[model samples]
Target: MERRTAEDRGTGTDGDTAAAPLPGRAAVVIVGGGVLGASVAFHLAEAGVRGVLLLERDTPAAGSSGKPVGGVRAQFSDPLNIRIGRRSLEAWRAFGERPGADIGFAQVGYLFLLGDATERALFEEGVAAQNALGVPSRIIGPAEAAALCPYLDPDSIVAAAHCPTDGYALPREAVAGYLRAAARHGAAIRTHCPVTAIDIRDGALDAVRTPHGTVRTTTVICCAGAWSAEVGAMAGVRLPVTPLRRQIAFTGPLDTPPPRIPFTLDFASTAYFHNDGAGGLLLGMSDPRQQPGFGREFSREWLAPFREAAGRRAPALATLPVSHGWAGLYETTPDHNALIGEAADVPRFLYATGFSGHGFLQAPAVGELIRDLYLGREPFLDIGPLAASRFDGPAGEGNAGHTGARPEAHII
Candidate 1:
């Protein structure tokens, strides 16, 4: 895999030509050039939203989307996530063929193991929901699970859910493909132009103020991901999005790597490891009490959980030293779900943030949903539970004893 560094791309200063007003105007303005923003730009342009302008504080794919573990799976506990993942997988399949870059999309399948009866029940419910949505997921016995992944210890797994359609996609390649295709379709995407503030009056968005200059557009879509709260605050809306740091590590290449298989998540151990498609392993796990910030600074200490979990699940990695690591943030919400759809007050302003840790794999479906919103059409999947207004008024259920979306103790 090609690692993207700061030196390879411009520092988002390429288009900073004086703080002059932008010429004419765009029908839609998208903030943040990461996967979510790029997908929206591409889809908006495809939906006939001409002169769509996308602004990024840095170069494209320089945020969480660039540094994510690039694992795609439809094996989610929530029905909405399953729908989104399925749609995204469909788009990825087509995207792999007609692309400027070959996004390494592989449907090696996913193995979500269960440790106890309660966990097995949850997995079964999730698998049923997936089946109802036309997703190809099923509950498999321990024997079947071991058959699918020979290295797995059947004795450790109480039950398992397997989804052959669950897969992975190279992040940068997907972003580049969408950007190039969107550019060809007539969208003007600009990087390094950070939107400093948003102009709002009467609870409606007027325009966006960026470092370069003010860009006037009738509609604005906020896809800032980890920095979504900052953009929402510009319009006087206290979005519930919060940034939480996460870390991932890579192992040295193995002489005889395990056979290619889909990503596996050991729920009991809170462990996840997958083949890097090059004889190495890519792994990650979440810290129960991780700090909330945008800075990439991380400690080597975060590797403890991953190392322990890997050793417990796959002892072969006991001697493998961590080659390198990457740090990123998860834009979280009160429900641990995304904040999609238009805000109740900010009429022309739409958002797609708070994806938790599933942004990279879910980008394709998110783009299509945003496109539907812009075209005055209903989203392919219901987005009612993710609106910004769901957090409004007296703070209702949230402040009055309702527990927020706590991360699963097992899987981060």
Candidate 2:
């Protein structure tokens, strides 16, 4: 995951596309073909927007979206995120009818294990907030938590937040679905095309340059995950995004299949696991020792700390043999939340990236938000707080009219 260029890999899930070839000019040019980008393309094209061009660095979902085990939940500690999560969940449920593709979505639910009283109290508040937002998440005792996932060590967990609506799905399938629908609606999706340069003249978008050719477009939406900072720079907009590597290991087919369970996480250690729905389990953790960078090579060394954390929470999973693993980039920002809003300085450039780890779940709703923003329609939610200018601090004369760092407050 470099600055401008995209990784040269996609899952090739994109089936036959009734899309167009590269055009000299387009009404809207989208950079990045991941789930978020593909969603935006579908929403915009479905809205009858013509001349829409989506350029992907590689195939769609070749980035982080193709790697991680998709966890969809609305049990956020904040209202904004919970709303986004809830809305996206509803959209994911209705995806098959409108998008005309099956995403393998399962509402197997999400369980967050809390280790201490402090964490318990925090989750109680989150559960209340989720309830208000129509998310049926409840704070339960360790006994109930262990009942849902038999592998859990009941003594290790003090409390848990369980949301039956939250679940896991296929990320690459969702991306391919969106791209296919977008293409059907007259959106040209060009793979292996990265936006090398963005030309802005007199504080307005001019064109987007790539290796294939340059396309003239006034509206450019950036869904580039880890490499959004460089795209922002080319357009004179500041998007402070960084890439951090996150890894996951898979236990190959086992003689005894794992019990059907929720996507469980040990909040204190950030350790998590889920049944692959195929005979084994997928295990992972946010390694605290990992330094932020573009290094995405999966390493067994991190498994040492992972096992320590997983062992403390679930004694049975600590000794599971890891058949294979992979490392992917988590596009992180200053606050570990997402960057979703139009740039005030460069109005033509709208961005939706830097989703610490919530991008997959929030993509569906964010697509509608971006589509509404581009169409000058009032979106269902007030996304003013998510403006990139929030990090700029004070709308001063020399600061290019940034909205000032008002703290988006989990506006993912």
Candidate 3:
């Protein structure tokens, strides 16, 4: 596996024209080369948009896109999220048909455990909503849940909502596919080109000034994730995107790994574990108390609670040593939901950040939505709820500073 770091620089014109000036003016310039940006780039190119450029400050997928747990599910509390995720899932299911390399996708499924009665009721409601949305999911008692996976401890789970149609997608593979397809469709992705400043001319995006050079673009789509607020600030737009830290760990291959196991989420502890499909397991837990910031340091202290919780949920996993662990940042918003649609104040500026943790699964739909906005086509999904104008109002004004909408513990 490639150890994704910030030093993997791409070919450049003497590191001065690193940002690569657009051919006069690009139809669209996407900031950030992560999964979201790649998806948008590919979608835009597929729409026959000429002169599409994707700018990356660091290595592609160096951010959350590379470290994503790849959990794709429709078990969201919000209807819009569910709908968007459902569309993306369908795209993944039909990935082979797309104009890109196969992402090695599989229907590993997802199992979200509920320990408390209140949470259990909420799970039931979510399951019902998912079913109504055509997601094959249902609530199951502890016995039934454990029956599906013999390794599961029946006594540990009070209830669980199982969704066989939802599972993980190889985010790295998917991003690679998008980049290749986008390039084939005439989209150029430039890396090591950090946008130091976004130049606005007469209340519109004029060009982006990068460390390498300036890129003239009419439409600037901010998909910088946690760093979106900083990018927005360049345009003098007070976007409320906050960078939050989320950590994850992986274990060595087991001697006798289970043939198949759903990606299980222990809601009681905000811990999640899943088989890595290579005789290994991946486990993670988020720290709710952790503040939002950009840091990738390892901490041994979080292991104790993680191990204790994992043992209670899957005793066999406790024996496996956590071979490696890494942390990344999630650009979150006040509502813990993504900020999509165009910025009312900035007509040409489209916001696609603040996905919190759901960005990976929603990438496909977001790509389609952004493509529609650029091509003058209808959006694939209803993204009215994720508009940037939501934070422009009085109530949203004060709440924009608040990033407490999503539980930090769910970062894993």
**Global fold similarity of model 2 (TM-score):** 0.91
Clashes within 3 Å, all models in order? 1, 3, 1
Give the C-alpha miss distance for residue 372 in model 3, angstroms: 1.1
Among all candidates shown, the one with the greatest TM-score: 2
Per-residue lDDT for 1-412 in model 1, tens only? 5554432222222233233245457778888888898888888877777778877777788888888888787667666777788888888888855434588888888888787898898778777878898988898888888787765777776888889987788887788777776776777767767888888866667778876677777788889998988888887766788888888888768777767866878887667777887778887777775777776875677677766765665566555777888898888776676778887667878899888888887888999898998898977887776677776766643431232222441154
- The local distance difference test score of each candidate is 0.75, 0.83, 0.77
**lDDT by residue for model 2 (1-412), tens:** 3432111112124432223346999999988888899899999999999998988877789898898778888888777778888999999988889787888998899989889998898788888888998999999899999999998988997889899998988998899888878877888888877789999888799999988789999999989998889888989888878888999999998889998999998887888899987799999888878898989898998889878988899988999999999999888777666778888888768999988778999999999999999999999887876666666754422331232221222222
Q: lDDT winner among the candidates?
A: 2
lDDT of 3: 0.77
- Residue 245 displacement (Å), model 3: 1.4
TM-score of each: 0.89, 0.91, 0.90
Instruction: Please report how far candidate 3 places residue 241 from its true position, in Å.
Output: 1.3
Name the better of 1 and 2 by lDDT: 2
Name the regions of candidate 1 deviating beyond 4 angstroms: 1-24, 97-101, 393-412
Alpha carbon lDDT at 405, candidate 3? 30
